[model samples]
Every structure is written in C-alpha cells, then in structure tokens.
Target: MAARPDKLVIAISSRALFNLGESHRVFEEQGLQAFSRYQIERENDVLEKGDAFPLVEKLLKINELLGGEPRVEVILLSRNSADTGLRVFNSIEYYGLDITRAAFCNGESPYRYIGPFGCNLFLSADGVDVRRALDQGVAAATLVAGDSRKRRDDVLRFAFDGDAVIFSDEAERIYKREGLVAFTKAERASAQKPLGGGPFKGFLEALQKLQAEFELDSCPIRTALVTARSAPAHERVIRTLRAWDIRVDESVFLGGLPKGEFLRAFGADVFFDDQPAQCASAAEHVATGHVPHGIANVDA
Candidate 1:
C-alpha cells in the first residue's frame, strides 16, 4: 500500500456529490419513506453532476500527476441510510470515481465521523451538519447552488474567507456583539497575537504541503484570502498567516465591499465564506461554499 503522509482526505455528502435536488425536494415535501422509495426506484439512474462534483473530480485527477500514488481520498459521508444509499453508490461506480469509503448515517449528521476518518475537509448540502462540524473544530462547508461551468483540466484556485472560515472567530464575535469600531480596536490591540485557527486550517495545511511538492512556478494550486477586513484589521490577518507559514498568492481586503465581482474576476474554482450573504452573492458568478461557523452563524 502507498504511504499516506501527504494524502488529502475530503468527506462529501450525497446531495453535494451529485444533483439530488429533485429527490431532496421529494424528501422535503413528502417524507422519508417516499424519498427512500423514490431513490430505490431511480437506483440505476445516473445522477447529474452538482456544484462540488467538478472540484472533487479535479482533486482526484491530481493523483494521476503523482504517479498514481493516491494522494487524495474522497469519502461519502451522507445522512441517507444504507438501504437508500445504494443509488448513490451505484452512481459513484458508474462515474468511475476512486471513492471506496463511505458512511451512511441514516438521519444523523455525518460530520460526527469526519474526525475519525481524519478528513481534511467536509462538503455537504446540509447547513446544520456543516455548522455542527465547524463547531467541533473541523473544516466543513455547506455547498450551495452556483454557476454550472464546465470543469477545466488546468490549475485549481481556492478562495477563502477570513474570520470563521480560515482564522478563528474571536474578532468576528467582537464585531457581532459590539460594532466595527470596537472590533477594529480589538484587532489593533491584538495585532501581534496570531488569531486562533478556524475550521479550514487543517485543509489549508494539507494543500500547502501538496503545493510544496512542486516548484512555485509549476505548482498546480493557487490560494487567495478574500476577506471583508481592511487596513488596521488587515494587519492581524497577515500576521496570522505569516505565523502559520501559509502561502497566499492573492489577498483582497474588501472592507465590507461586495465580494461577488471580485470573485468573478478571480475565476475561483470555489469560494468559501462564513456569511450567507457573501456566499449568495458570489454564487452568481462562481461556485461557492457556505461555511456556517463563528459568530455570524450563532443565531442560526
């Protein structure tokens, strides 16, 4: 067996892995029994691709560049029970994905198993599950609808939010409870202290390790920090990344500006943010993931 030192493990849910909007609608409108029956009836039907499918396919293809060493592993962590999950497995086999591990949680949140699997990232359509995973200090995102662009076989670009998505939400909590003034003061006062790691820290580390394997000019991955923090608040973010030794190719501190246009211009493969408003806006131009974490999602 190949060594697993540099492996990047991603856990994905059924709905995020494939286009199950119709089936999900059935489940929402009717009930679990109807949904199970529907899935069983359409067991052989190949599911259409969803937003995260292209990203997963591309990540898996990266292994081919590594001489088939299997540097990436994608696990299916779904809320569907084993009986109703046959359709998803069949679809995976039909697509020829190299995914062999899976967990059918029936109605439970699959995030509970992410830690046990040592997954670097988790993508799901369930907001609650994503939030739970984030609270548990795991890198997780709730995938939302986005522009259905065809997948490219070139470089992969990842865009991440600042608070709660990449770094901890301490400043975000202050910002939420107080206001921008108090938040800025808090950040400036603590400029020297590196903020705590957020849910996506582990995933970033994995990608950084992968990036190190290749030369800078020829690296297949590029990362960006697209945050709403600006000026004085930006100092803390820079120090935090520097402290972590993570390389960010691009940094855009928008200072509360709309991020949709910038994300569109960047041509990101996927954008992850904690705020739903930003995710909804970015989804207009590019694929977006909602990280339901930190103070922004405390009420939700």
Candidate 2:
C-alpha cells in the first residue's frame, strides 16, 4: 500500500479532469498507437474543461480558503503513459489546478491505485474503472457529462441516494425480492435497525472531517440525501443516519418523484445515485455521478 495522507484525498481520472472525448475516440476507433501520436502532436495544446471541471475547481478552492494548508488533495489517475500524458500535465498547469500527484497506468485501469492514495472518493469517465473501485469498497462514481453549467463556486454542495449509495443495498435487495408494499412493511418493522454503511460512507466521514475545520453556519460544504423514500420509509433512513452519526445538511424524501428539478433547487455541485434514471434526471440540472453498485447493478 502507498503512504496514506491524513488529508481528504480525491482520486480523479484525466478524462474527468479535462475533456478527452476526441482523443478517447481516437483510442476507441484507432488504437493506443494512434492515440499516443495524436496526443504527442498536440502536447502543447491545452484541453478544455470536462463535466467535473467545475466541481474539481471548487474542491481545490477549499485549499485556498484554508490559507494553502491543503486539507484536501486531488490526484490524477490515468491510463495514459508518462510519455503520452505530457499534454495532460501541460493542461493541468494551464488551468492552474493544485493537483500534484498522479499515477500513469499506461492503458491499465487505475483503480488499483486508490488504496495507496487513500482516496476518500474516486471519479472517472470509465464505468469499468469506477465499478472496479467500488468492488474494493471505495467510494467511486462514474461521472456523467450532464449540463456542465457552472454554479456558485463558493460552496460545494453534494447530494447522494440513500440505499446502495449511502447505505447498503440490503433494503434494495428486499425491495427487489418483495414488492414495494412488503418492502415498506419490512422497513417500518426494522426502523430501529441501522442499515449497513455503503461505499460512500467513508467519503462522507472524510467530508465531515473537513467540515470540522469551519463553523457549521459558515462551512462551504453542504450534503443532501435525496431518496425515493416517503412517509414510513423515511423513518428508517433517518434512524440509519442517526445510528451512523453522519450529518447531511438536507434530506429530501422524493418518494418516487423526478430528482432533477429538486437537485437543481438544491444547487448541487454533484449528485450520486445508483439508478441511471435518477442520475440522468439529476444530470440535467447539475453534475451527476452514477454509483454502479448494489441491486441496480447486479446485472449491470
């Protein structure tokens, strides 16, 4: 294992940090050699910002607010070899991102490096890599190139789905096996039992650590739990959060309504959900990441 830093470390792919769609297309259609030549030919050209650029920008801004103490660190994990990755570094310098550490995996999935880097969260354009990270019990999200509109840069807001994201898919499995009526009954009966922690649990805890650095009223970070749960189902989620001792600034129980408009209203920087439908909706409003885990992803 690599040295784990005490800071809140975030691991992001090069494609997530910058727009690499053109070059990625080259790799997909042509192959690695063509992609390598293409990148080398344009090594000096600065890449445009990707969907996650705004979110990454705001996350790094936290360090600036802390007087350069760098309580948060973002790492670059890419499939590009060092030789072909010069353009990425060049663009990073051009954007003036504070990121300094990276792992050039040379066309390999970079998920293996997550533990060594002590990543509280990992985001990637590649769904395969994201799934691999989640399999290792790391909080990972597949970044969706949604609206890409930049929001207020001062406060970084995050939203998450309850089951299969913040909590285990146990309840989700029950819901799948049994009908909604039975699932609701089961939840109501076991309301006192704390649901198992999901992948993003550690990441949320890390955010709490960072939040501790500032006053609650002034903290620039906000989190929300937006779920399809309503009425009796909401109690279990509330009790589960209480049991875990985690703090979410806002908890919206959508109870099967579309979440995009609500997420837009919340001014979320990024929203995480296991359901593609929910993610697609949220992406229309803000940056969204698909957590391909649990029952929703059993066949996925």
Candidate 3:
C-alpha cells in the first residue's frame, strides 16, 4: 500500500524558492569564500521570487484554506551555511512565508535530509540535488527559471509528464532503444499491465488526498498529465491511471508536439518533464520542473 496522504510537505532549495542568480554567479565565478562573503555582506537584501515561488505560495495557502491546521509545510534546504542562509530566512520573513525549518549545508548538497523531514516533494535549482532526491524514491524536480505566472483562479495547477516522471520509463526505454514501432507494439500488448510507479507517484497520491479536503467544484488544486503520446499509444496511459485509481483533472496526449503552448493554454503553475528539451520548451511559457529520471536523462 502507498503511504498515508493526509498532509503534504515540500522541501525546496534556497535557489529554487528565491532568485539567487547573483549569488550563484559569485560562487561560480570566484569561489566558496567569495560566495560566503557576498551572502554575508548582503544579508539584509531581500531576495526576489524565483520560478517556484508562486507554487510554494499556493501550497502554503492550503493550510489557510483549512482553518490554519498546518496541513502543509515548506522546508528550506540550501547549500549555504547557517550564517549565509540567514539572508534567505530573513527574506522568508519579509515575504511572510510560513516556512520555519531549514538545513544549511555549508557548501555541500542538502538532499540527504529530505527523508528525515518527511517531504512529499523536493524542488531544487541544482539538478544534482534533485536527481539525488529522486534516486531516494522521493518526488524531486529541478525548477526551471522562467516568467510563468499562476492562473487567475485560486486553483494550483500541476502538470506532469508521463514516462519517467509519473510512470516508469519502461515504454520510454523500449522506444529509445528499439524505435517507436516496437514501443507502440509493446505498449499495446501490455496495455493492461500497470506500469511501475515513478518517484513522483507518492507525491501525486498525497496531492490527491489534499484535494479531497475541498469540494470538487471549488477545490483549490488541479492536476494534469501532459504527455507526448496520443491515440492508440494512449491506451496504456489511461489503463495505468485506472489501475492506480488516481484522477487527473486533464490529460493531453500531444504525440510528439511541443508542450509550451499547451501548458500556457492550461495555465499551469508548474510542469514536470524528464526531458530537458521539453523542460526548456515548457519553461518558455510556464513554470517547469525538470525531473531527471528515466532513459531520456541518461546523459544528465
């Protein structure tokens, strides 16, 4: 059985939650000492919102919608040490975000603490941290920086890719290795065989439970499956969802088309895809999360 899904917890990197382009550049151009000094000196400078800021805001609002029971929590995970991360915490206070806990990892990756934190989802700017989190079977993605905005309604929209993200890359591996024809044949033959759940499955399950807290017509969260599969190739996807007993507000089978415009039309708060090309294309129009899993990300 899947884990309980009553509440949701998110682990987000400092760079993903707020704009750290300048600080990151310092670290890249100079070195750790220069980066530390830069952060410490600018401790009072409030950070700007990053690509995943809107999504994080919406996630926190769920607790407000639920009469402040704190059903959702956002934990900060950063590469900065406690001294340097003070600015980030100050920015959180300035923004009035409800985030309270954090892990200041000095100059190391902060992915190791996600398990202890019981995070349902992990979003980071570093692909390395995101991949490490996903490898531990936690839902993780690298937030793509872009100019995407939230929908007009209060609903939090989440869009996901099919293979290597929501579902295992079994079919994708077949397609990548043998070709589309063989993949189609394989999927059609195994349409009834449920695909293994990927890293995001648990997070999706928790999100569904959260949605159940509100009425369907007035729910504040909406989800979509925006994939590059269409027609006869879509059967296994439908069957897979049915097998999992999960519901998606929308499912678009693009069958190899670009996803940016479609995501824009859907007003997605964020879209997660395994392919960097797709993430780049989607980031052109919507907030995107690059899930570095499966065969498409073999080189990543």
Candidate 4:
C-alpha cells in the first residue's frame, strides 16, 4: 500500500502565533500582554519574560484540535538583528517547541515576501501587504485565530462570495473603473450570462475530487455562499457553482450589509473573501482569509 501523505504542513511567523486572541486568556493568566505591545510597535519583537510558554501552548492546542492532523512548522520573522533572533530561538527552545524547522529572515525579507511555505492558509498583520499577496494567488488571512470549539466532522461549512472571489471581478472592476450607472446596466444586460471563473475555481475542483473520494452523505466538507448580491444577480452565482459541480450546504445573500455576523454564526474554520473591510471584520470573529485581487503590481 502507498504510504499516507504527511499531515497538512503550516508555516507561521511568531507574530501570527501570538495574534490569536482567543488563546489570550491563557497568556493573561500568566500576566503577559504580548498582543497589545506587538500591535503598538508594528515591529516583530521577541516575547517578553514568560511570554513564550503560553504562545507555544496555544500552538499545541490548535494542532490537537485539528486532530493533530496537520504538522505545524513555525518560522520566526523579526525586525531585530542576529542577537534578537538568538534570544527568540532560545526562548522557543526553553518553551519546548518541537520545532524542527525555523529561520531568521532579515527585516528586508518582509519586502521579498512571496507567500507562506506551501500553506493553504497565509496570514499577515499588515492588511495591504496581505491583500497584495492574495491577489497574487496566495490564500492569505489576517493573523488572528479565534477561541471556538473544535468543529465536528459532521457539518463542514464552507462559504464564498460572488464577485472577485467565486466569480470573476471583471464586472466589479468595470464598475469601479467606470461608474455605478454603467455597472448596473452591464450587469442587468448580462443577467442571463455567467462571468469568467475566479481564483477558488481550481481549489473548488480539487474539493470536488476530494468529495468523490468520500461518500457525499458521509462527507464532512460542507460549503456555503455568502455574498452581497441579491435576487436577480444571485441566479448566476448559484448556476456557476452548480455548473462547476460544487455543492454549497448553506448560502446567504447579504446585499451590502457586513458579513461578520453571519460568518460568525456559520462557525467556519476559515473564511475567504477579497474585500478588506469584510475580511477585517470577519477576522476579528473567525479565521478569515483575504483573497487578494488586482493588487499584484504593488507586490511586484
């Protein structure tokens, strides 16, 4: 029999690890306020005294809740010099991280940022840069993890947006570059048509293949569509997903209202959208990924 593939591999910066507020309670009990300071400095600094233990514990818990299914590798990226890197490494070792993989990227490495190392989930504290990475095809998120119950295998909830995410942003782009009047007229004229595919298309196809590997009824991966498009415009969204043979278990048409509340209620492990406003709000309440669109030139 072929050997089973290695569990999912995650590469996280130290900042990403501590930014998780849900796990903050543990750190608070230990009398550490690492998050606030890190946010204020806007620099990747080493943990204060006794700060490393709680952060490492949170990482271990995240791994455990995922059934230890994903082997997590953390890379500490800081603006400090070699001495600071050595201190951070020493603290990590003192805290007992089974970290077989790590590296020290000079502060400049942030500018050379491509994407996370083969991780489906990339996170960043800087919104603009994160979005830029996403637009370039990196599935990136704000560096925040929530404290929620480990999701059951029974109801796997997946959610998506309409424009620029699940569907081509061409219309939105035209709308942005032109005017609302022209955009509405164009959308109405093409009401019976579908736009070109979006980034998630290939990933959705991979999901379909994975679904076929397991029986649908027993399949744990459930999907949903949560978008601002309402009514007449909604038809194309539904049809597009159907045409792709992808199944969404739950869907909501918010029509310009914020998606944070609905996304929180949905209890998603990871949510992806292209809008920074929506992603910022959702990231506060959930593991949110900002799908970057049209910001590639900035990174380039």
Candidate 5:
C-alpha cells in the first residue's frame, strides 16, 4: 500500500454544512422575513442574531467524525457576500471541536472550483453543482456526519459500479449505441480478454498503494464493486481488476437490479457511478457520487 497522506482536505459548500432542517429553522427563528421567489433569501442577515449556530455545530461534528486536531481542513463557501466567519468561529469554539483551520469565501454564487489540491471530498448543498463538478472530474463528496471518534475511519468502505467505473464504458456504449445483440456478442468474445481503461484507473492505483502502505491485513480502506452486469460479462471485470493488481474486498454482479439494497448492506462510505438514476437512489441510502464517463460529452 502506498503511504497514507498525513491529512485529508475537504472543501464543503455552505449549504452542505448545515442540515436542511437546521438551515431552514435558523432562517425562521431569526425572523428575517425577507423572501425571494417564495424562499428565504435574507437568512444571512440573521447571522448577527445567532442564526449561524446550526451551521457551526454541523461543522464541528464533521471535524470530530473525521478525527480531531489537524486531521481535516474545512473550507466553507457561502453565497452571502457578508462575512460570517466570526459567527462560525464562535460556534466552533462553543461546540469544542478541534478544527485545525477554517476559511470562508463569500459571493452571490455558490459555485466554485475547489480541486487540484487532492481533496478526498468536495461537498455542496446544490446537487446540480455537485453533478456538474463530477462531470467536470471532481468526484467524491464528503458525507455529513456527527462528530464522534467511533465513526472515524470505521470500516472505510468504498463502493463502485463495474462497468465504466473499473472497466471501460465501451461495452456499455456499444450496448447503448448498437443494442444488446452486439454488446453480448462482444462480451462473449472478450471473455478471456480484459476491458480497456476506466475513469478510476489512477484512483485504483492510489488505493493499491494505500493498501500496501497500510498493510492489507489491517487496512482501513476496503473496496467493493456492485454492478448490474452478470455472468459472462463478469469475467472481463475480474480480469481487468487482476491485470491492474488492485484488490477489491467485495464484488457483486447484481445483473440489472437496482443497487440500493446492496449499497445499503455494504455500508459504504461513498459510492461512485456514471448513472444518475443509480446515484439518485444510492445517495438516499449512502454517500453516493457520480463519475462522468469520459467517452460521453462531459460538457453536455
């Protein structure tokens, strides 16, 4: 396994930091009645009256679960132009969370690029922006959790789909483009052969390095592949993984079934795929992410 990085970097969108209910409650409790398009737009004004407490609590809890004291960096991006760091800081102090550092970026737009720094997770309250970022190559958003040492790296399981995730999406594209007949014929012929490259090729290599660095026996990172392609298509998946020398703790070929049940049973920390329907359901059950297939029009 490769050496584990000393710290994990996380850039969190402001809305993602606060739970939906908490944010809404904060707006109402402050009595900041200004509304825009029938939604509260002046909630930021209430921060001076202590409406940012919930957001702070949520941040502290996230820091706790991620391991306290220099383990994580929380970068908050807000849509409000006013500075809310002082209130956010006071809330962190009140919660007694050991946050090594924190930063806030204020603007009317919540969308921002936060990558190229090797952040393990990039979270946003706006699902649309999250999707766009994933399509643009930023995968793995952090899951919101309460501050607790028990959940820190507790069975850090990662789940992924077989097609497109580990193997190239070529076969799936053929199926989609030319229909099932050609796809099946191609799969049968490629049985002993391996699929082409995948979106997670580098990530897989990193995980292998991580596994070796931590020692596979007591490794904190575990991986699973849950795909809908079964039987004949399974061989290529196995061969591809073997050729890459990457170890997957669990692999399930569900053969065209919804992956929600399996993902829930696996208790994955994050699951990645290229399909929205799959991600939409998986996100309801776990910390799910979408990895855009390069073959497709990423900009589209």
Candidate 6:
C-alpha cells in the first residue's frame, strides 16, 4: 500500500455518527443482550443523523473535489461488538456513506487504537474516551446532540473555542485556580507573548492547508474563534494565531454572553469548546463538540 501520511483521518463512534439514543437507553435500562436484539431487529432501518453528521458529510464531500481519491478518510470506532455493529454498517450503506473501515471493540476503550489509526480527530459521545484520547495527545471531542442549522454546501463553517482548544490551557488553568482579576491581569501582561498550542492546533493547521487550495473569496472552509474572553484577554489569542500564521475568518469575543444565537447567525456546521456548559448552549443552535481538555475537565 502507498503511504498516506498527509491524509486527514477522522475516527467516529457509532453513537456520535448516528442517532442511537433509544438503543443506548435500552442498553442502559435492560442489558447488552436486549440492546443487541433491538439493533438486530432494526438492522434494516436507516438511522437518523447524529450531532456530527453534517460535519462528517461535508468532510466526505471534500474528497469529491479531488477526483474521489479520498484526501479524507472516516473510520468507525465504536464500543459495540462486531455482530452488534452490523446495524451501523447497514445504516452507513443505506445512507451511501463512503466508509469501509471500522473497529468494534465490544465495550473496551477504542481510544487506544487512535494512534494506530493516525486519526487527525476523534469524535464520540463518550466523555471518558474523549478525555483519554486528549491525554494521549490525540485531538478528540465529545459530540453533544444538537439541532443542526441550515448548511451552505458551498461553504463549510467551523467555530472553535480559544483556550484549551486552539490555544493552550495555561490561561484557563490560571482562571480556574485564581479569580477573574488574576486571569485578566495575566493575559494582559502576556499579551505580546504567543500562547502555547493546544490539542486542536494540528487539525487547524491541516484545515489551513486545505483552505489554501482555494482563493479567499471562494474558500470552502471558513473558520471562526468564538470565545468568552473579551478585550485584553483577546490580545493573547490574536497574537498567538499571528505567531502561528493561522487564518481565522471570523472571531467573536462574547465576554460571557450566551453563544447559541451567535453560532446560529454564523451558520456553523459544527462548533467546539472545552466547557460542558458552553457546549450545551451551542448545541441548542448548532452541532457542538465538547473538547474535553485543560483544567475544565479535571475530575474532583
């Protein structure tokens, strides 16, 4: 096989890739046997779209522009057994999704295989798996179920959090430990210094490379920085991106304002944040991914 070191590989869980809420509830309430039977019975039924559906669909479409040689690859990484995964594969076929690779760990953590898969990003509904993936230096996000906004096929919009996502969690740790005043002072003091890179930095860099394939006016990918930090805190983020030579088409400094309406107006295909509350809020308006990183995710 030829080398594909540059391919953007994305591994997704069955639950995050499809709408399996009822089946999941059955598994939790009854037992694995009952859940397996339910899935087997509904094997022919096409599953509904999940939180990451739009994003995945768009990513797959990016291959079409390259004569279908597949610059992007999507893999199924789920906790279900191979037999139980038949329903997932059936749905994938029903939807005509171009996915041919999968790993059904049968309840074991699939994150351990992320490195072997060379996944640029991992998306799942399981928080524990996401946190573990981040800890292992892989970019992963917990997919929060949400209502998808109207998507523009010609343009794909992505909104990301500032701290603990695109930038390092240093500022976030200070904020979590100290009060707002200390965090603000620290950001202002380090305004000239570039912030450290976080988990999603490589993914953003890859997207930037993809963006370069088209003109600015005609670029298919549009990225935004939608963060809660305002004014002085924003300087560090700007300088950080400048130092890294990354392009952000839009930026919203909310200053603690709710992000749902803003994300709706941006018509984002997906949004990512480190905080659970922010993800829940964004989920109300658009598909949201919870980046489980930094002090915000530390267990008590």
Off by over 4 Å in 2: 1-5
lDDT of 5 at 74: 53
Q: List candidate 5 stretches off by more than 4 Å.
A: 1-8, 20-82, 85-103, 108-113, 131-136, 140-153, 191-197, 292-300
Please list the Cα RMSD from the true structure of every candidate, rounded to 1 decimal place: 2.5, 1.3, 1.7, 8.1, 7.0, 2.2
- List the candidates ranked by lDDT, beginning with the highest: 2, 3, 6, 1, 5, 4
What local lDDT score does residue 214 receive in model 4, on the 0 to 100 scale?
A: 51
Q: Which window of ten consecutive residues has the lowest lDDT sum in model 2?
A: 1-10
| TM-score (C-alpha, index-matched) for candidate 3 | 0.96
- lDDT over C-alpha atoms for residue 122 of model 2: 93
lDDT of 1 by residue, 30-135 (tens): 9899999999998999999888887888778778777656878999998889989999999899998989999998877788888788777888898888877766
Give each model's whole-structure lDDT: 0.86, 0.90, 0.90, 0.55, 0.57, 0.87
Location of the lowest summed lDDT over 10 successive residues in candidate 6: 1-10
Per-residue lDDT value at 250 in model 5 = 95
Per-candidate TM equals 0.92, 0.97, 0.96, 0.60, 0.66, 0.94
Count backbone overlaps in model 5: 6
Report the alpha-carbon TM-score of model 1 versus the true structure. 0.92
lDDT of 5 by residue, 1-300 (tens): 221265444556545544344544554565323212113333333232122223234434443453445443455554433344344444445556444444344434343445544444456655565555555444433232322112234456668886776667888888778876787788889877878866565556555554564555766667899988887778878887887777789999987898877987886766777776677777676666566554442453
Instruction: Estimate, for each residue in 2-60, the C-alpha lDDT of model 6 and write its tens digit.
Output: 11356878889999989999999998999888998998888888898787877888888
Q: Which candidate number maximizes TM-score?
A: 2
Show the colliding residue pairs in model 3. 228-255
State the weakest 10-residue window (summed lDDT) of model 1.
Answer: 1-10
Report the C-alpha displacement of residue 177, candidate 1, in angstroms. Answer: 3.4
User: TM-score: which is higher, 4 or 5?
Assistant: 5
lDDT of candidate 4 over 1-300, digit per residue (tens):
111123223344555544334324433554334433433343344444321223334444434444534443444444334543454565566557655555455443341334434433345555555555456564444443443333544344556766776677887776667866677677777766767777665445544544454565765556667887766556767776777767777889887788878887887656778776677677676666567664222242
**Candidate 1 wrongly placed segments (more than 4 Å):** 1-5
Evaluation by TM-score, superior candidate among 1 and 5? 1
lDDT for 199 in candidate 2 is: 87
Q: Which structure among the candidates has the greatest lDDT?
A: 2
In model 1, the Cα lDDT at residue 156 comes to 79
Question: Which pairs of residues clash in candidate 4, taking residues 3 or more apart in a chain or in different chains?
Answer: 135-292, 223-249
